[model samples]
Target: MNKYERIKAALNFEEVDRVPISLWMHLSENDINPKSLAESQIEQTRKYDFDFIKLMPFGLYCVEDWGAQVQYYSKSNQPPIVKKPGIESIEDWGKLKVLPAIYGTYGKQLQLAEHVSRKVGGETPFVQTIFSPLTVARKLAGDRLLLDMKENPAIVKQALEVITETTINFVKANVNAGVDGFFFATQCASEELLTEEEYKIFGVPYDLKVIESYNKETFFNIAHIHGDKIMFDLVANYPVNCLNWHDRWISPSLAEARKRTDKCLLGGVREAPYFDGNNKKIRDSLLIDGTVVEIGNHVKESIDSVDGKGLILGPGCVIDQQTPERSLYAARRSVYTGAHTLV
Candidate 1:
């Protein structure tokens, strides 16, 4: 089967020629320019031959237009840094006016997604990355969010409502740009960040609204629950085709996740060695400095972990830009060598 059909079969828990595979990372320098970002993503996808293209525009693009100051470095691999919180006080939350999805930073991302869509055509399944409303709010407010959410609950809820509306509009704009789906990432879902009660109130509602906007419009939607101690059971049932998290670093391994939900699982290779998960050292060594043979063996282990059904081989989060090119090539080629095991 081709990449498209292979991904569909994996999502549906049907037979696939091999497990679908993909990985993503930030192009910090190139991502600042629309054409350059498009070119970088396309070039990498073509080189590695991933099953899907998860568009990696800088993570700060969603909040910069809303009065948040950001510092961009051309020489660095790190994402653009936030200079200060957009919300300085409780009143600042009320000050956030809804920006049009087709204007400012949000509009620039829409253009980037459009460029990627037209270039890839239908050969590769591509998704636009969208941070959850709470995550965007955190980007704007930083640590003040927790204090405000507790001290000024009403005002916080009001702010999130507007954030949610703007995100829904953004999702619609991306849909118009011809994206196959969204990689909805919730960076603030960790228990260390918010309590279960808090996330149920602030995160889940808005997250569902943004995701539900694309329900009938796209089929390859993925919910990426970022960070450890995440509110897993809550986000597991999100309206998406696959669930991606730090499975290699956290509880509920891929095998355990299969019992929690029937959704396709999209993690295997850990993004790095030190993250909080089940097999940190082993996964870390493989991606960091492992031989081609070792990388291929890890790929086979990931596939077999899920019994090769409803699984897509990938890192829990984006891989580093410094990762060896040979390791990536090994990851792509491993499926071919490991395909026989699934039979």
Candidate 2:
């Protein structure tokens, strides 16, 4: 079956010719320019021949327009780091204003999206990465986000409204860019970061607003609950159709998650480490000679939990940039009817 047919069947919990598999990683070195990032993403997709493409827009591009001091990295494997956050104090929240999604850093991403859509429009589906409003606020304020919510909720809520508006605008722009869906990622929906009560107050309302804005037009939306101690019950009920998270590394294994939600699950291969040199690290009880992605039938076991329907074989999160090509080939081949070998 074609990519669209395969994805549609999996989304509807039907038999697939081969389970859809996609892996994403930050291409920081090429993400600085729109054309550069677009070309890099196209190249990466062709290299793996993935089932779908999740646009990697310089991990911190969302915060770049909001006064974030970003430090770009030159290494292909290294991610760009945030030098300083936008919101430093309660007063800084007052300084926040709604920005246009089609200008500045987000504009560059829009161009990247458009370029990708034009190149791979009908062949392979692509989704843009959009952080939840609360997640964007957390990325802007850093560690003090929770404290600001408690001590100065009124100001924080006001800021969130502005952020929500911007996110909604961005979602609309991406929809116009011919995106198949969005990978709606929420990094703040973790117990280590916020309590259930706190998230209900600050996270849920804003996240829904941004998601429901384009939920109708998008066909392949995935709700990604980032980090550990996740509020699975909370985000599992989001309007999105697909579920992605740190599955085996955190709570609620495939069996448990299937019992809770019927959203097409997107994980199986444990993310291989970033092997730059010969520092072989043990992961998933496998001795990696730096050339494998979950070298076992782990994919089969994950699919068996859902009876091989409504599942997409992939890494829990973005794979390490330095993960070897042979490893990715192995992961892609794991979903097919053959020995997981590189041709």
Candidate 3:
């Protein structure tokens, strides 16, 4: 089966020729430019032959237009970092206004989606990365938003309303640009950061709003729960086909996740470390020797662990941009090599 066919079958919990594979990392150097970002992703897709393209737009773009000061270190390999929050005070949250999704960084990302869609055509699916409204609020207010959620609850809700509106507009634009679906990322849905009741009040409502905006419209929406100790049950029932989390680093292993929900699971790689100089690291109780054979063995075992159906081989989170090229190539090779053995 082709990449698209394999992914569709997997999501449906049907048999696949081989489990689909995809891995994403920040392209910090190229993300500042639309053409460069699109080109880099397209080039790498051909190089590694990933199953789908998950557009890695600089994560800060969601709140950059909201007056959040961001510092881009071109000389360094790191993605852009936020220098200051957009909402400085409780009153500032009330003063926040909705911005057009078609301007500034949002517009550039739309252009990127259009370009990639045209190039990829229907051969491969490309998903736009979107942060939940609460995640955007965190980016806008930094860690202080947590305090304001209790001290000034009303104003925080006002800001989130505007943020939800802006995010929905952007989601609409991406749909018009011909994206297959969205990779809805939620970074603030952890017990460590907020209690279950707090997330229910401030998080899930707006997330459902943005997701329900395009629920019936997209075919491959994926709910990516970022960070450990994630509130897995909170987002388990969202209108998405796949659930991606730090499964290797946290609770709810693939087998356990399947018991709670039937959505396709996308993980298995112990992403914290992909390669070693000596090619020795503990991954799924196996030692990696930085060779194609070792990588194939690892991938095959991961797929078998999940029973292969309803599984997509991928890292728990983004890999380091500095990861070795051979490691990625090995991942791709593992899929094909494993396919032959399974057949």
lDDT of each: 0.87, 0.84, 0.85
Residue 124, candidate 1: alpha-carbon lDDT: 89
Count the clashes in each prediction.
Answer: 4, 0, 0
Instruction: Give a tens-digit lDDT track for model 1, residues 31-87.
Output: 888888998889999999889999988899888888999998854467788997688
Q: How far is each candidate from the true structure, as Cα RMSD in Å?
A: 2.7, 3.6, 3.6
Q: Tell me the TM-score of model 3.
A: 0.93
Q: Of the pair 1 and 3, which is ahead by TM-score?
A: 1
TM-score of 2: 0.93
* Clashing pairs for predicted structure model 2, backbone only: none
Could you tell me the lDDT of residue 333 within candidate 3? 75
93, model 2: CA deviation in Å? 0.5
Assess every candidate by TM-score.
Answer: 0.95, 0.93, 0.93
Q: What ranking of all candidate models by TM-score puts the best one first?
A: 1, 2, 3
What is candidate 2's lDDT per residue for 232-281, written digit by digit as tens? 98999999899998885677887789999989888765664432247554
What candidate 1 gets wrong by more than 4 Å, as runs, is 275-285, 338-343
The lDDT, on a scale of 0 to 1, for candidate 3 is 0.85
